[model samples]
Target chain A: MKKQRNLTMAITGFVMLLVLHGTAYGLSDVFKENIYVPEKLAPTDSVLKVAVGEKAPDFTLPSVHHGKISLSQFIGKKNVVISFVPAAWTPVCSDQWPGYNIVKDLFDENDAILLGITADNIPTLFAWTNQMGELWFPVLSDFWPHGGTASKYGVLRSDGTTERAIFVIDKKGYIRYIDVHNINKRPPLESIMSELKKLNQ
Target chain B: MKKYFVVVMGIVLCLVVSGSSLAFDTKPPAVGDVFPEITFSIPGESDYRTYLGLSKGEYFSIQDIKAKVVVVEVLSMYCPHCQREAPRVNQVYDLIEKDPSLRGKIKLIGIAAGNSTYEKKVFRERYGVPFPLFEDADFELHDILGGVRTPYFIGVRIDSGVPRVFYSKLGGFESADEFLRMMIELSGL
Candidate 1:
């Protein structure tokens, strides 16, 4: 009986290992394939319309998750990070927001909220962003006045798309930092973190 | 009965040892160290087979490839830097393929850190990357690779029959030509 019991225990242990291995393998494969959106090259020409120490222009725009979001609401309550991308569905733009998704905790640690703005329409923004998993921040559309917010900030390209830009606004409504990155490249995350550290101080 | 107990204990010990290795927290391989062996299936088998001359349905290991030098790009489908560097990396692959001296002597592969197979496929198709790319859904390879930032490059020299990391960079290279030249120089090929 003792021999039988030992054999049973060994078999049980082996089965458990197999089950765990199978579960992990199955989980990896279960992530259903998503749509493949071809990437577009963004233009390099960018215009910076705003400067540091300026009050960020307040505006309301439609959100992908919420109906409408305004810049002024977070002025006194929270430090705001405004991330402007050139457009939706482009290589840089698509990768930019999803990168932000992983760094949401960094924004939270700095007591900031990120507002992702693009010149694409709501429908376009919805479809494009859905390709990325759930985003922790709001994505706003500057579509209808056709880049009104972008133009106000001087980042609007001649073609009506926004420049790849970032504005760190302090709680008192003053822009603390500004980066008008080349439209073709991504602004390094470390630089943004360094700027946020200054805002925290 | 004692023999059975010993046998059962041995089996249990083996299971625990194997499980622990897969339980995460393996220190990432560092510069000058032999690259750790990892088995992964590349997404889009046909592309890899045709482009890299790999066999169909075969799992790949860093030590198994026949090349004098290997460039391993640790990236993520969601990383903006990786996305921007995609075309540039393709250029590196093109140079490796087109150069008569470098042909069959150099290989390029990408590991999509923390990305699922589905995500890896999307990235591969979107970028039109001709090289083989694998998904590290559990981040096993990423953790083994030191959890470095995405768009990082690790160059391995295999001329000694044992692969050792010779170069590692945190961000994108300035240009494809510059990167290719650096790899060739570092590989001493």
Candidate 2:
């Protein structure tokens, strides 16, 4: 009887261990739905020391497209989508830019211009642009000063890097949408599309 | 026969001893529950067993830090929010490091979901984060804390028996300062 009890107990313990392992294996996907941000509280702010609803701070950053372009140039005509990436070669930004590239026409149809801003130097941006294909959109270099554009948007990290932030500015230069994401999770395209729809409406 | 009984008793005692270690049942620290005994290994230059571990004090039940306030930072190498908040967290670490009373009382710990040593090293070098980060590859402690995303924070108060979790979130971009201030307040010291 004693031996039988011990055997049964050991078997039960083994089963529990297996159960724990099985449950843990599915944890990442179980919590996947909790990964998103609620749409209402986006980081909508103007440049450094500036508030949202105020005119966005404008500057001319070197573009990967050959010539420098002032953000002011896009005013009154094109709704601008400014995507802030931490660095050029990082994995998240790599997927993010390509995703934007695939949807370039969608932005154009919505009367918007998509610009990717990064702290990486112009040379790195140039290499990435060339490798990533002839990017119709401009890859802005905030490199010399390091995150000058990111700082203006209050999305620059203290370590002199840009946070992954997505901002949609209306034709009148009023900030229409903002979505700052955790580095690992991709920015929600559905949310961005919805915000764009609202702006278009 | 006498020797056989002695051997059987010895075997039973060994079973009890081993079973006790395997029978750990730590409850998840909810908002009101205090932080429990945190027991995990930290990695050093040579040995994996001898990294600095948090001092084990009497367990508190109320949501509180053993010292005063505890800032639990849930981090992942792939998390952009964590990366962005890394420099900010380092800034707060500097502040906490400067204050002697708040040193051991209010603490910052980075919990990663089993990141590579190279990645972690880059994170440390790139952000200049001063606090020691804990790796939980097995998701054992991560499961206990119920942390879903990286760059998340769980504030605890250790005034009572168990450390009570006061605030918990998956990311820290919007509430960095507010969270720090709350930790300072919770740390009665």
Candidate 3:
């Protein structure tokens, strides 16, 4: 009787294994059926970081000179490019902001408004802009609540600093292009130009 | 003695017939359904160790784990999506960990597939994951959980054993909040 009970248990365990195997096979087949898109797909939902093909969330941030420039303020007249940076005095940011300032004319040629955003407070932004020899674009200060705009954009790191991400919003308020590269790497300039060129066409 | 033998034979026959009923239960996980029994191998243990052989305790079975809402993340350490999600998941984990009422009410299991001890250690150190991350060699758990790609999430209800795929890609890490809120509602917690 004991031997018979042991045999039954063994058979039951064996069958459980077989069942698991069969279920796995069917599920794997289903998994393989859904192929990945070759390029960036449209955002399923509106997230903090601007996703491609989604309407950009509107906000009113204090501009350096203007009392406040709302995102909607640019809706009908200009394409908007919000450049999120980690901080003002960092090496890469120094180079990045100056690069934007140097290309300010090109950006205008494409009918885009370039605004640099950082966690630095208004006083600090003012000081940095002066020290950096006057930036053409408003170095918008997201300072009182450091990186508030960055948080809304989903680019704020746990460390309370914004990531270096470029968001391009067309006149209609739809996000046209977004490129968020790793902190160490600068985005390819050609890619940004190409995306802008698409808007022009 | 004869009476005892007769009773034992009846019991043995019943066991045999029940054993034959081992077909797969075709009922899939509904939106809020819980899950079946799940046994995972603990990482950092001996590689030569035998497959884990144990029963689901009264409260810790897969059924129990699913009795509340759960998000099972199956990922590989080498996958970039997994790495990116690691920080965000850690943020979510920290939020839950700090809440006294929410502690232990939700379950987030990270199954690391095809990772060596070094890799798992790096992830564990970097993310400071509070829960056990079972190692799944060659994606055995991935196969069981529907051959999901790395960084995929299987959101399941604890009471119904029902599962729904919330994410199937590398970029869905940003939706951790949404995933957690849905889990809370579905788990009835």
Candidate that would win on lDDT = 1
lDDT of 1 at B142: 72
- Candidate 3 chain A weakest lDDT stretch, 10 residues: A23-32
TM-score of each: 0.48, 0.41, 0.39
Looking at model 3, how many pairs of residues clash? Answer: 13
Per-residue lDDT of candidate 3, residues A78-167 (tens digit): 998888876665433443554354456668778988878888778766765554445678778787676677877787767666777889
Model 1 lDDT tens row, B1-189: 768666877777676666555444344466788887778663455656655555766576666676878899988867766877889999999988899999888999898876666567767877888888887866677766655556778999885568898887677877999999988887788
Cα displacement (angstroms), candidate 2, residue A73, comes to 0.4
What is candidate 1's TM-score against the reference? 0.48
The DockQ for candidate 3, computed on C-alphas, is 0.03
User: How well is each residue in A21-46 modelled by candidate 1, as lDDT tens digits?
Assistant: 32111111111233222323344455
Native contact recovery (fnat) for each candidate is: 0.10, 0.01, 0.05
Which regions of candidate 3 deviate over 4 angstroms?
Answer: A1-49, B1-189
Highest-scoring model, DockQ: 1
Candidate 2 lDDT by residue in tens digits, B24-45? 3322356776565566443343
* Highest TM-score model number: 1
RMSD of 1: 18.3
